[model samples]
Target: MEVLLAVVIGTLYGGGLYLMMRRNLVQLIIGLGLLSHGANLLIFIAAGLRQGGAPIIAEGKKVFLTLPADPLPQALILTSIVISFAVTAFALVLFLRTYQEVGTNDLDEMKETDT
Candidate 1:
């Protein structure tokens, strides 16, 4: 199961990077989405898989496998996901505006301030 998750994460990361290298703004957005998912999956897998876990409490005694999954990673991933969504939305809007004003989606055609 862990192996499978690792494979999935790897595939996603690879595909995201491949897409990100393209000149199209839409493809770049898609790549970022894929990359975010891959990162989330990596964090989840790193937390390990536990079927049963004891509740968190003071003076609570529990073993490693019997304890609840780490909450930190979950929280971080959730926050990251939310931030990613916001960023993606902003990027999409910006991309659309750029497309309209510049008349192209090719990033390479964009000129720097100095140019």
Candidate 2:
């Protein structure tokens, strides 16, 4: 499972980078999203995949009887998801406005127009 997840994370990172190198603004935004997702997954996998109980102590228990799942990565992923979503939305809106004003989605064309 870990190996599979590693492959998936690698793929996401690779695809994201590949798309980001394209000349299309839309593809760049998509690549950014993919890269964020890959980072989230990497954090999750780095925290370790274990079959354990929730990270909560039972009532009247001084300590956990079983291994508890790490909550830090989960919290981090959630926070990152929200951040990525906001960034992507903002980028989309900005790109859309630029497209409307510039009449092009190609980065090369946009750059050329700046001259």
Candidate 3:
């Protein structure tokens, strides 16, 4: 089960990176989203695969049968996701504005031009 999850996460991350290298801005945004999901999944999986039990700690709890999830990784992934979203949004807006100003979506065509 862990190996399956790892493979899935790895594929997503790899595909995302590949898409991010594409010339299209939309594809890049998609890649960023995929990357974020993969990262979140990876973090979740890294917390350890437990059989059963709640993660919350009750008052005066003696012992836990199952391993508790690592909250730190989840927190980190959340922050990273939010930051990635902001960056992706900014990039999309910039792409739109660039299209409006330059009249083309082809990045190669937008290369520095001489007057």
Backbone collision count in every prediction?
A: 0, 0, 0
| Full-model lDDT, candidate 1 | 0.87
Model 1 lowest lDDT segment of ten: 57-66
Candidate 3 residue-pair clash tally: 0
Task: Give stretches of model 2 more than 4 Å off.
Answer: 112-115
lDDT by residue (1-115, candidate 2, tens digit) is: 9999999999999999999999999999999999999999999999999989998999999999898989899999999999999999999999999999999998988665464
Candidate 1: TM-score? 0.83
Candidate 3, residue 70: CA error in Å? 2.5
Assess the local accuracy of residue 64 in candidate 1 as a C-alpha lDDT between 0 and 100: 54
Structure candidate 2, residue pairs in collision? none
Off by over 4 Å in 3: 62-66, 113-115
- TM-score winner between candidates 2 and 3: 2
Which candidate leads in lDDT? 2
Model 2 TM-score is 0.94
Q: What C-alpha lDDT, on a 0 to 100 scale, does residue 24 get in candidate 2? A: 95
Question: Against the hidden reference, what TM-scores do the models get?
Answer: 0.83, 0.94, 0.74
lDDT of each: 0.87, 0.95, 0.81
